[model samples]
Target chain A: MRYELYYWPTIQGRGEYVRLALEEAEADYIDVARCRNGESKMMAMMNSRRLDTPPFAPPFLKTNKQIIAQVANILFYLGARHNLAPKPEAARLWVHQLQLTIADFVVEIHDTHHPLGSGLYYEDQKPAAKRRSEEFWDSRVPKFIGYFEGLIGHNKGHYVTGRRLTYVDLSLLQIVEGLRYAFPKRMKRFERKAPAIITLHDRVAARPNIRAYLESDRRIPFNEDGIFRHYSALDE
Target chain B: MRYELYYWPTIQGRGEYVRLALEEAEADYIDVARCRNGESKMMAMMNSRRLDTPPFAPPFLKTNKQIIAQVANILFYLGARHNLAPKPEAARLWVHQLQLTIADFVVEIHDTHHPLGSGLYYEDQKPAAKRRSEEFWDSRVPKFIGYFEGLIGHNKGHYVTGRRLTYVDLSLLQIVEGLRYAFPKRMKRFERKAPAIITLHDRVAARPNIRAYLESDRRIPFNEDGIFRHYSALDE
Candidate 1:
């Protein structure tokens, strides 16, 4: 298993979902393109013509044969490999749907600070962000999180996939952590309303492999370049 | 063998993906929550979704006891049921990853006009949307379309999966049509650089079932409420 992941090295952005899955599965993979003098290698993967199906963007996972992109779809592919997804077709899709929901939520999270465009700086879009964030806080965030809360209520277990620890669970765990990191004051106000989600995050963090991974040096600390950036103006 | 789709009546929206598959497969199904006095029926479905797994929004499909939401997931789940997707695990994952990429691209299309928040009216966000459309035209649109061009260039045939008119093929066709509808001048410019993708779109639309669907009354026209809406301000 070649298992190469291409993503920005320094920030735990969307790419972190891919990283968490590989770590929890105990897969033999390297964050190969993130080392010293490795930016070109990452660019080369982006430029690779040998790949039959190249990824639209990273973080893409390449085994010797298959290259899968999109965090949810990567997990879907990897879930089959590592038994992180449920087997029956219906069960599998429920998991996939949950992951897509997470991606949608992540988009809203990013939009809270960059509603105008990704190409422009935050300062340039601050007014737009402020308006978007207010709407996001009042409506979108609770709806998205509440949807997850509903999933937990339905699943009859701590995980999204009903008694199974799937990648969506881990990713949700990360989202909760990232949200708290990004919006500490807001998250505190809603903690009681989203107890199941908070508990799920706590449970995922305490998992043996995940606990060790978070405690270890392998986990990249969240920073400004990532999705969950700290903007004091938007946080409130 | 039972399929029930939940979606809005007045708009095709993302629900069309599920509709196309069910039509092509000649499957036993009902477009539930869409009937005489459909608004009431739709609300009834939403109310009964007192379950945690209730769809975050409509365009959800139910097969027997299993409910699936998200356009891509529905296609994915149905692709296997109807043999539309590749059987090989890697190939299946590859197709799924492509679908999610298209999903991301679709959201970007919606954001072109609804850049601030989906909750806000288009008129309210028009100023910000003008800026959003500019970035999408100048940067994001070409990058996404270019990425697809690269993927098709990798394979022998025009389709993303090669020799198979998979859901991605249908989706790319819809996307091409949508982008063309939503951003004609920009896409006209984009088309000059992406002939292969344009050809793939042609092939997908030219498929026997797809052609019929395109000509049929069931194929709803793109409207202001749908993903592809024409606003002169959004166009270059």
Candidate 2:
């Protein structure tokens, strides 16, 4: 069955994560929020109580009678769509653990601006953003990257899922690239010390599906409107 | 085998979600965080490199060598461990979607205080917290509760695992009760309107193991340090 991905039309935002997975899995899916009058359709879908479950926000997904949301949760759902996650009980949980890390990283990226409140405008909270950015890079960013690098060191594979590429690996590639775009100098300091993670990021970027998606108009550029905003104040 | 849960010594915080599931399931587990000289062990457990994957933060679960983190991810893992989620592909994905919605709601709860950044003191950021709390109750709180209430309405039983009591039901129960404690005024306005959700909360709390857990000092009281903190300024 084809999947219907509901998200904001212009900015990649969280929807981009779902989009990458669908494209990689070679699934037939429609970007429901991107087509003609799609945003209105998303509003209508949000109001509909047709399923046993519903998502609280966009970047939600649908197939058959089921609907799901949250980027990492979406990826875990889609991992079964492809053979991306390992099958044993222990292995599957690892995939999930990695995805959750990505989610934490994503929240930190968003908080770079809206440190005061997601509802408030970025311009209204630039000073607080500066301080939040400082705290994030000093404490959070290194710890997260170091953890992933250590995981790669322990796992003995290029991808988070060992011999195969998994949803977590793809998202990690996105996160590292996003950070590089958003924090060039800080990343330069990080990349060498964490070679395994950098290698993983580079390998995922070179994949055919990801490369195609990145080059095509399907991928949106990073903007102040989305999660990975390039606020110079956030970077060291 | 026993499951060991590692989180801060106090504050139901995120650990409460895991604690609720273990209690409701009557599983063998230890809250390893509260013992004498516990911080070092908690720190070491958190920093352990044995994970096939690494967690970015706490509220992680470990059994043998496997570890899982992120509140929603932990529940999803435990759902499988204790058969708390539906086994069918469609049902499992849908449950995960619901958990993600809860994650968003949790973020809203935390933002009521950290509106200006987690690094700053609540006293230092009370002004921004006021605006954030107002926006939360006015926009997000209703929007999220409305979504979950609609989801419960779509299903038949008190729980989302059809007739079975899934971890999502227990967690939602926590959200409902926590909100009542934290946002009595706003919740009073909305709670009666969502009967199924309210019933679900009561059902989970009424479970024998969970009821016992709540009555014991082991189930920490709601405090400013946790997600569902109450401050007069944050209320209408």
Candidate 2 chain B weakest ten by summed lDDT: B46-55
For residues B1-236, what per-residue lDDT tens digits would candidate 1 score against the true structure? Answer: 67878888767678877777776667788777566666677677666646656677788887767777898888888888787798887888888888888888888888988988989999999999999999988899788888888778878676777877788877788888888888888888779999999989887777787788789877778889987889988886
* Model 2 agreement with the true structure over A36-113: per-residue lDDT tens digits: 999999998777667445567788888787777778877877786587777786777778777777787788788877
- For candidate 2, what is the DockQ? 0.61
DockQ top scorer: 1
Error of 1 at A16 (Å): 1.1
Candidate 1 lDDT at A18 equals 89
